[model samples]
Target: MGRIGNIINRKGKQDAKRASVFTKHARAITVAAKEGGADPEYNAALKTTIDKAKADNMPNDNIKRAIDKGAGAGGGEDYFSNTYEGYGPGGVAVIVETLTDNKNRTAGNIRYYFDKNGGNLGTTGCVGFMFDRKGQILIAAENVSEEQLMDDALEAGADDIITEEDGFEVVTAPEDFNAVRDALVEKGYEFVSADIKLIPQTTTVLDNEGQVKAMEKLIDLLEDDDDVQNVYHNWEITE
Candidate 1:
């Protein structure tokens, strides 16, 4: 490929990434508003989703349109959430959470991705039991003292803190997420990301190159789907 080809590939990837982010965020805002009503003050889920969208630098106009759509003023598209469980390469348990207006189409795409990527989509609760739901937050490891972080996180009701070379990950009970986050904010700590996540109980390490590649492709396919909100797997592999 020539230089022009590389440029086109990069642009295409960028466009796809942007479109994926926009679709996911818009659908999140719409669904959150619909479920809890359009008023953020009265709807904690909507408020949090909207804040996440804004954090990703989503346009206010787009957010407003989604709110209107959810309020039945525009778009008229109805969306619902779905989850798919499966085993990926190396028998790694995988979970895909989706927001879709067309369940049939979303199901088909998810099945196809799993099948083509050397995996099989399975029934609900198949892989779900191997995970635990927790509120997780991450902060960059730099410019912060470990002692201070440990003190603040523990005082803020975090259940545990895992320090890595790249970042500090704080885990909290689901019900304590907001309280913990607010306490950290008061201590002037900024988060890289904060979310309720399904943490795996165990992990499969894939040393085979083929298995690693297949797992990576499988994740990319699931995440690239317009309806997918999140994808989780217990594969400890590097690309």
Candidate 2:
């Protein structure tokens, strides 16, 4: 499995953190709806965001309210999507995605987290070039046969499919993501996790224990912040 897959799996098991997870998803949904339209049928981005939120078991009511809030059916704060690039411990490339009404507060918090953990935030695109944006869909191995999935996924326009011990990872180009995912869904396939993600081209490994601890802390702090939606890093975490 990819590093992002591992992170998703770990987060999925953290039932205690469900509230925070939902908050992030909700924020993303609102942003997608506001940028595009609230109607998922007319808005591809909103549709994809809704699918992901549902996969995470976000409440239907919460999803509706988020859409309504974004559509201006109800009054809500205007949220701006921001991306921050940085180097974590051991020169690991990191990208942080956030949705916030207050950019200054979010920027300060992100910079502080990086500095406190032996990392330094950098200008936009500083570490972004180290990654590629793609759509990644993970499905449990027990849910489908490898042969069947391979045929279906390829026919649906996926770029590649990787079989992992616990699941299958279906990859698609950014432009083809919505079509491929929707096609698979129409065929009755369910995903364990599905979303557009930044896949790192090369990874960095921290040999020093202190660096590893700092990196882990940095990630935890970023994820815990309500403003942060996603954090991508080229840190090769091993068991």
Candidate 3:
């Protein structure tokens, strides 16, 4: 009975985390739709964002509402689009992806976080070259053969496929993200997450104690900032 209770509690916590992540992702989709166009057909980026939202279990109503807001018909304000570059502890380059309506406010808030957290915000090109824009997809590895998965991804134009500890990671070029994802879905693959993110070209290895503290502080700051849509770094997190 004790073990069963613990299992239930763990599942509940996992569900909550998933829900929160989906909410954040939904905000990103809304912002992307507003920046580009409501029609996914005409806007490839919007389509890619929407596909990710769907994969995340974002409700259809929520998706429609976000699109309406993006179209400026649902009383949703416009969001600004910007990228922030910075360096964390141990000179780890960080890229913060943001969608904000007010650049000054966002910048001030971001700067404050960095200042307080022992990092410094940098100019536009300071750390961007250290990362590459890549389309990443996460799918459950359950009941799926590695060979089969690789074959499908290769046929669908994936750049690389790897089996991570938690699941399978599918990588694609920025342009082919949507088509490759759709191909996998048509073939009945269960996706965990799919989106374009700044992938670090090389990783910075951190020592034992510094890793946890830096990661905790970074996550707290990033999650609190409404302007920060996604945060990426090349800090190699190890057990």
Per-residue lDDT tens digits for candidate 1, residues 1-239, read 43223323433664558867888989999999888999998987887788777756689999999999988888588888999999997899999999999999999999999999889999999999999999887777668888899999998899999876566889999888877877887889877667788989888889988888898899888878889998888875432
Which regions of candidate 3 fall more than 4 Å away from where they truly are?
1-27
For model 2, residues 86-190, the per-residue Cα lDDT tens digits are: 999989999999989999999999999999999999999899999999999888776599999999999999999998777788999999999888888998887
Which pairs, if any, clash in model 2? Answer: none
Local accuracy by lDDT, each model: 0.84, 0.88, 0.76
lDDT of 3 by residue, 5-71 (tens): 3323433554556656566656777777777889999888778777766755678888888778777
Candidate 2: segments with Cα more than 4 A from true spot: 1-5
Q: What residue runs in model 1 are displaced by over 4 Å at the alpha carbon?
A: 1-16
Candidate with more favorable, higher lDDT: 1 or 3: 1
- Looking at candidate 3, what is the lDDT of residue 198? 84
Judge candidate 1 against the unseen true structure and give its global Cα lDDT, from 0 to 1.
0.84
TM-score of each: 0.89, 0.93, 0.84
**Of candidates 2 and 1, the better by lDDT:** 2
